[model samples]
Target: MTPASTDAKAIWRAFERTARADPGATALSTPGASVTREELATLASKIASAMRGAGVREHSVVTLMLPNSVEFVAAFLAVTQLPALAALVSTRYKASELRSIWAGIRPDAILVPPQHAAGVARLLDIERQHDMVVPGTDQVLRLLCVRSSGPASVLDVRERFGLRDPGSFPALFKFSSGATGTPKAVLWTAANVGAAAANVVETMGLDASDVVLAPVPLSHSYGFDLGILPLVFAGASLVIRDGFRPKTILTDLVDERISVFLGVPVMYRVLNRTRLDQVPDLSSVRYHVCSTAPLSVAQIEAFRRRFNAPIFQHYGSSETGGICLHVPSEIALRPGSVGRAMKNVGVSVVGTNGGALPAGCRGEVVISGEATAAGYVQGETVHDRNGFQDGFQDGCYRTGDVGFLDADGFLYLDGSRAGVVNVGGWKVSLAEVARVLESHPCVVESAVTAQTNPRRKQRVIAAVTLHDPAEEAELIAFCQARLADYKVPRRVHVLEQLPRAASGRVVLSADDLPS
Candidate 1:
């Protein structure tokens, strides 16, 4: 295998070569069926050939909106083979959100599933209503529709739109919810992605013998990095599931003899809630990785006890790739820690003055590494001289998380520096409160913030969406029991749905809740 630094395009070429070397080996598996390496490569080749015939060239931006399936993998690799930029858009995004994203970066072409054509057409209509000019059609172009088991339609949409390759384009554009209250797209190059993928494979000690079961959506960072990229790089078989269901997941794990399981804390919590006897014996699995959100000490320990496998809690953001992870050896010793920095990544806790702090002191966690991204699409560059070091000094990417490293090199997260709430001099982490509220039985989702109180200065308020409205008080009582007196929410507001951005992060506004 070639080193990750060889070139971003080299990784795809290597995978294509590997597929040819072991044509009959299984590459991807889902509940519906499985695809051999030969089949996977042939499908990708067909798609790439079709794209070339349709006038796609190097550096063209192709927006992909599809569900998690074999088609997604084929489309992603097919575009990358031409070294074209691939933008993976969430299927859940609304028309308004789509307009905002498309307006900023006009993609040369778009690939949507047949099922999403109507919703996409609706979005184009909404765009026209606002006098916004979409890229392809007078309305949105229903250009490419993926067939179940046949050839892909290559319409003259590319010629119709008069699109052409501009030049060298970013490898991927992932939209993230910005702190300034808007959606910001993060641009990453093929080189950056290849480095990040290599870092993950090395850090996790993955091998071709490993079988990874992924239940998270590939559009998100966690799924894309840990779930998809590592498997592709290591030539490991991927067991792709559309979504997470504890019972079904457990059954698949045992049946597939899965070696690696990656998911979020919420998924593990759901699995832990299932009856122990009903849970399959996952003795074959060696690692269970969790990220996207924090995993409580209780949840971590519970998962370990039930599964008899080490549960690694990792911490990272979409801006920078995998930052920190708790090692399997330290699982028992440092239950809450996210682990030491991975190879080629620098981790630091800086004080308010931007100076590096001593061990055991809480400060903002900053990271720099090979996996760090170039920058956001239209947002400010986060790299700084004192902190970021021009992207070379130790290659450390400054992570915005607030955490501290113990004397033994274990990283303990305190909270996020951006989302802290000052309640009359008492600092509270909104993430901490949100975690407690989300643990409630009736609460499906929750967002916590500091609401102004004329007399008390500020009070903790929680806006929540519940499965049952009548259980609001009961849920509040549940949170009151688990959280500290100061951390407990003083007021709980029930809503049919919580506001969220296209990236799936909760959106809170001053006028949305009580002040």
Candidate 2:
């Protein structure tokens, strides 16, 4: 097997060439304005030089929370020039969520939206609750707003900041969504980012001619790596939206002449439910890549039939950028597979004993090679229930997902090990059902789990609290209409209340249930 290709010069070299080759070509754009490659590079250089003057060194960690703005792209590209790792924090995160993440990272510098400055300062005051060093000018951890307090001196573009060794430090630090529980910070080295971008560019045949859409939040790894970073190698045009709205995106699909769309399953579900009288001509779109969460077969089929567009499944996590992407030509062969491991990456299925499982045998999935991150910060386990660990074993990062590899090497996910309930060889995801149930007006909140009955196998069960009185039969019918027959919960129990964790995710346990 070929070793992980960690050559990290691709981003710097590609950015320079793309800028010089066509100085006037648009590199990134929003509804407000556009920036050419030359202009973007110049802005990035200025930001990098300014950051250097603030005493941030190659080893310092910089956290960025600017979203859906041209400044974010410029700042991220500027971070590329410095050896410091840029951590992208979600702007949508609750104040408490942000505090939890920030307390742990204690970034050497933070770039927050100007409006959030006061709130963030309050969050820092709460930092005294955690065991972390508060950041400021006393050295490494300086905080900077996206908008400078006062204006500005332009430093030489050819400054010392641009001379740092690109491969000497990790390039990214991102956090999990914390949908299941507390979020964990994950780090990706320069090699990881470069390899992931290369894999995507190769698999999709994306190029300078392609116009990609940032259909999701740029702060999320989904948008940063898939939507933004891929442009480093391909020099493609990026169309940024203010935020995700069903009507706005549909309009852009036709108006932007977009060739590629980076989206998630939730977005597609919304689109499918919102029918179109004429499925706007999406002939220009070559790849409608979906990731972030698993896309159900019903959702996928509905989207494809309605739009006449191929909805390819992309499976990966914040820890590992793009593990599998369904290629267009191979779609017919492997209908639901996440596709094979990308170039310079390795994937294998492992049994309960941590032994390699044969083709078609479901087990925990483990991935390795250049595209995968080194590990989570401080070796913390992101998902404790999964049999996998944080770091790579034998160079492979044990993903907490359970799935089997076919003879063709296509990986099929069996849902997350913690979230998937096995019912006599059939797999059901609790997260999937929760979404469907939450759609019902009566279902104020719900939790899904499994319990073994006389059948000797686990049966799907959903516990729900209602806004108004609703019969169990009606709710079951509601799910039956939305999900696959097998995926529908076997039992829907009406509970007075559901237990919730600090992160706001429903906790499913006997102790938390109503008596």
Candidate 3:
């Protein structure tokens, strides 16, 4: 299909056709109940109607700070139906963080569950104060309090406004990695969303016959692209996991007959800790899709021993969706590999000076395709190339990750450019160091970071979680043997588990490290 025809309305029209053809098919299965495609459409229509009643129009931003419930999905689909833009944010965002996100967005309305309504109001107030604005000086932020029971939305479908004609305007805002309180909400157009969903369907082989398990938070881009958008576009059943409880998820996988399992590295590590005596019979799951963070060799081995399936590592970012993926026709994958580039996507490694690096040479990983977002959205400034390294040439978004492409075009990730630790004069990969530590027999997971030494030089530090108690000195020596002298961790902090963000990436903060 051509770019103009493959727009958001076209994707949404496909969904409407699916619902008409098979209204009885289950579209969403959550902790509460199952919603059929027919019922989902009805609810989305009601939400869309409500959005119009609330004065939401084309290009109006409606920020949703809700949980991974049916309501969240309804609001998002409604936005696309209205051809209006929306931003999904974490409900657990701190007040300051909320201020940062809301202040930048000129939202037409804000959606929140009743419990969080007060917080949202206060956050808006903070945003006004932070920006030195008076009442009615900015866009009127309408508050739509969503109910937790009965229906996904409060507005009645009978009070409906005609659906708007979908155009080239951005429809969704996908946030970058959760490290920053101030998020650079990456704008995604309907065309971008459709192209991304189609890419997943074509490359990952997702279809209506599959039931997907999503433990990743839907608010993040990884989950939106992998978990929500693809399922909605394909008219497939989605098992929405509210939280990552092993027992509940394990039971649901079998009960729901999940055919595709989407998870992250931390989730796999936690599942690896389950006793062999009580492992879930995940035979129904054909594809164990893992992304967001890199999987260590130990983790891969542990998953192999625990389950009969192979975890296909996915490589992408908020800037681009599903850059490289594992397909059935690809050559056998190597360790630490994230498969090859998807259809219509181009990935290359480039030096700091924007020159392309030869295959097998480490450098910044750049992506170009329909999957790449429109770039960061701030107040009055939608920097179309803010996330790119050099500039936006050929639709490429420079992924801050440091990686190398092999001879066969498979991508090998060492770590992120931002995650590198400088030790005196030498630079080392935090992921590389953690991979070596996690390889230890007693270790389950690990995270490495940069710390200031007494000499005021940057030193490498480590934090590890072990199945069995082990000496820190012994773990350090193990890394010393596998890594170069400068790359070895100068100090190790033995912890039960590393502090993690909602996305399951290890959180590197002063509190997470030793004094």
Q: What's the TM-score of each model vs. the native?
A: 0.82, 0.76, 0.86
Task: Extract clashing residue pairs from model 3.
Answer: none
lDDT of 1 by residue, 408-454 (tens): 87899876777787876778898888878876655656777777755
In terms of lDDT, model 1 sits at 0.69
Misplaced by over 4 Å in model 3 are 1-11, 125-167, 178-182, 278-283, 328-333, 386-391, 453-455, 502-504
lDDT of each: 0.69, 0.68, 0.70
Maximum-lDDT candidate? 3
**Per-model tally of clashing residue pairs:** 8, 2, 0
Residues 181-298 of candidate 3: C-alpha lDDT, one tens digit per residue = 2456676766787788878877767778988888778887777877887667777788888778876777777888888888887678778876655776564587788887778756
> How close to the true structure is residue 347 of candidate 3, measured as C-alpha lDDT?
89
Per residue, candidate 2 scores C-alpha lDDT tens digits across 357-394 of 99999999988766766555532222211223454444
Residue-level error in angstroms, candidate 3, position 422 = 2.2
Worst 10 residues of 1 by lDDT: 128-137
Error of 3 at 510 (Å): 3.3
